[model samples]
Target chain A: MDMKRILVYGELEKERLHPVSLELLSKAKEIFPESDVQFGMVLLGSGIDGAVAEAQKSGVDLVYLLDDQRLSVFHPEYFAAALIQAVKAFNPDLLLMGATYGGEELAPALGIRLKTGVAAHCTDLRLTKEGKLAQLVPAFGGKVIGEIFTPNTRPQIASIKPGMFLASPQEDKNASLSILDASLLDSVSQRIRVKGVNRKELSSLPVEKAEVVVCGGYGIGSPENWNSLEQLAGKLGGAVACTRPAIDAGWVGDESSMIGTSGKSIRPKVYIGVGISGATHHICGMKDAGLIVSINSDPNAECFNVSDFKVTGDGNLIVRSLLEALG
Target chain B: MNIIVCVKPVPDPDKYNLLTIDPETKRLVREGIPTVINPSDKNALEEALRLKDLYGAKVSVISMTPLFSVDKIKQCLAMGADEGFVISDRAFGGADTFSTSYTLMKAIEEIGTPDLILAGNESADGATSHVPVQLAEWMSLPHITNVTVTEAFETKLHVRKKTEEGSVDYEIDLPAVLAVERNSNQPRMVTAKGMVAARSKSIRVFAKDDLDVDESLIGLCGSPTQPGELIVPNLKRASQELKGEPEEIAAQIITLIKKSGVAVAV
Candidate 1:
């Protein structure tokens, strides 16, 4: 019997594995069930002793630790080189990375170095009858499904988008773990220096985290009327979101507040869409909302299909009418 | 300094009302969809042109798509790229981001490295936001995603990075790859002279053999990921008529929130 091992790259901070790392482990278990699949996680940076122990709890069979200060900040070249070295050494059948900012940048470069194929923004995974890795990805603007297979490559690479998969809870607290030295610290390059790190604070809520969300689209007319939706959201105790059109109109911030495949993926409880025509890119983000209410004047709008409830009338007029009825 | 800008021709998102999928086949029936250069990538091209105006650097454009996209490449040429290259082959079809990046790397190698490379932060079609960073990784160069402002000096590239919460300014060494946000700058319109020049300039076309590349690694056979399903979410809305004054309607909304179990202080 051929052994199939999968390497999941993880970040451990203060002894706790990042949530996405555990999600990868669970997914690997599901894909390679018949083969003897052991989870090998790579931890880069210092103060990860506790993280190594946490990997045991998450069912990681082996942990590769590359403890060094140079890896504290993710530099594409250094990280890619190190990952390439590790993959060459382990020769795992598959490599998985989280679709975070760092992973987005690192996966492709590593793929090029290893001379393998990489599927970006993958939502599902499975193994083919021929024992190759099969990845489910979106194609033609998310309008068509394309089942992709890496027939000629070993260690097929993929970056899984966050929130696409559910992470399984640890069944046992005492799983066996073996720690190995990555020993690739010498390849770290200091060509690029992190002069400073600064984070910004925005006013609107993250669409993904909102319990109730109100989104406006091109049907909102202009940037001036975006405030009306904001007023409505304030009254409803929810946040104001927008489709890709509204973001292009400069009515809302590009990140966090914009709802689409290119922006934030939201799964709010009650999503009230105002004037949104429901483009596929925008609809994919909020399709999981518990109850969706769409309001648009276009009787034949696409947003009507995914919505639980719909109103075919002017958004401003409907908002005003609702406000009046509430009084 | 020489620079290269990569662009993709995608279906204009504004023109199509709703993409129709064959319930049986689950594939988009693209019989009559009008396509255009991706909006964000237009901004990247505009930035490259602005840089050319500032420093008189030569600019080139590259695209990987079907033969039909060459017309869009001509449109890009009219927007002022000194030259253009179109990479099209049957083997390149159904490529995921990783396979796409390898093909792009081959094209870049054929064109030779430049002082800078620019692309849109995300394409409307895939919206993966992975290609630029992946390209940077492949080239072993520094990259700044979601850059709002870009300035080039001797051996240094300065930019304002877009963060989740706010923006931060940073300076990285030159020969870096950048993915510009659509909101960062407005793309300029094509000029008459540029259009005339675009008509005269010849666009170079390449197949799988034009560059030194591994055939198995350049197409669908090499890609590790595949599209499982495309679901057109049902976004239908429920209608209710509110017959009352503005204040009464507002009060009713408040009541509905309370009924829905969302707490309100007022």
Candidate 2:
């Protein structure tokens, strides 16, 4: 049997392994045929001992670690250089990472250096009958899902979103851990200087961690109509969320409060969608919500299909009525 | 300064509902949908044009699309791009972000060394946000994505990039690529005079052989990722239409909400 190599870029957040990285390991184990593949993980950062140990516990075959101070903060130039050097050294058959801000910046850069193709923000991944990797991505404004393949590229690359897969079971496996030499550190040309960073304090009830969420979409009509939804959310003790359209229309503040492929993925206990047309992108963000209740004027609105209890009525009028009835 | 803005013509996002996936080909059926410059790319072009207006600079727009998208390219020209290039060819069909950026890299090399390159953070259709960084890597240039503020100096650029947490400011040397986020700047509409000038302003078209590129690396053959079986998502819902007047319907909605365990004090 021919052995294939799979390398997952394990992400670390504040010296801990990101849950999404474990999710990738879980997915890598399930999708790639176990008998014919070696699963490994690559970790890069300063003070990565904890993450490295955590990676070993995941039961992957090998763990490659590059510890350096320069990697403490993410510099695309440094990160890309290190990743490219590792790829050249390992020559894995597949590369996987989360479709995160860091991954989004790094994956394409890596693909460019390797002269290979990369599929980004993938929702699903599968191995074809011919044993090629297939990446399912949302395209055409999230109206259709495109199943993409990289037939000719070596180390087929894909960056996936979170909540797409679950973490695998932890079992005792003799895993080899090796730290790479710092030779590539000299090649990094830090061109961009980070002057400063200004981070916003997430709202008390940030949508990503909220228990209950009230979401509004384009069908909400105007910014003025947002009040009705907010009122409903206030009464229901839920945080307010909106789709991309609402954010683009300035009804919602910034991209953080938006729920969709480009925004945040939320799995609240209850997600109430008001006037949402249910684009595929919007659904991906909130699909994992415990129970979905869609209220749209159009009965045929796409949001209803995924809804547990859908009310067909005008969004603005219905929300106001719901609020008044509660009062 | 020489600034090149990468623009993509995407299916009008407003008509996304009309889109369908070719179950056999597993590709978007974008035949009749109207095409427009992606929303953020317009912001990118607007930022480029603003730079051109402030300091003397030439803004050139490049897009990889079919020949049918010439009008969309001209729209950028009308918005004040000095020149436009469309790397359109049958061979370039079904090129993913990597192939698309490789093609753009070749076109950029042929266009000459630019002081700066700008593009939308992500395409409205693909939304990969990969082209800028990929192009930068192909050329070995430093790049940043999700830039909300930009200031150009003689040899470097001052930019504010948006992160998941907040924003970070940076100063990148010359010949770097930056992907602009939405609201970077409001894109200008085409004026009649601008339209007339666009008619005379030449738009260059690059075919496969126009630049030094390996045939194996130019199109589908060069593309590493290919599509597998496409699954059409089942988005059907059990819809319940609330009957009667607004008050009566509101009462029923309240009942459902209360039953769901979200208490209503009333």
Candidate with maximal DockQ: 2
- Could you give candidate 1's per-residue lDDT for residues A1-327 as a string of tens digits? 133778888854234676668878788777766546666777665666677777767766666666666665555555776677667656787889887666766776677667666776676787666665667665545554456666556777778766666688745655554434445656565455555556656555656656778788888886667877787677666888887778766787656687766666677777888898877777777877776778777887777877766666677776666544433
lDDT of 1 by residue, B65-89 (tens): 9998898888888998889989899
Clashes of 2: 9
Each prediction's DockQ against the real complex: 0.40, 0.63
Report how far off residue A183 is in candidate 2 (Å). Answer: 4.8
Clash statistics: count for each candidate: 45, 9
Encode model 2's per-residue lDDT on B1-266: one tens digit a residue. Answer: 99999999988877777777776766557678888989999999999999999998999999999998899999999989999999988888877777788889999999997999999999887798999998888888999998999988888999998876677788899889999997778899999999988888889999988988877776776777776555556655555555777778778766766676765677
Q: Fraction of the real A/B interface contacts present in each candidate?
A: 0.41, 0.76
Please tell me which predicted candidate would have the highest lDDT against the true structure: 2
Residue A33 C-alpha lDDT in model 2: 54
Question: Which stretches in model 2 have alpha-carbon errors above 4 Å?
Answer: A1-3, A33-36, A47-50, A88-90, A172-176, A219-238, A288-290, A314-327, B21-28, B242-266
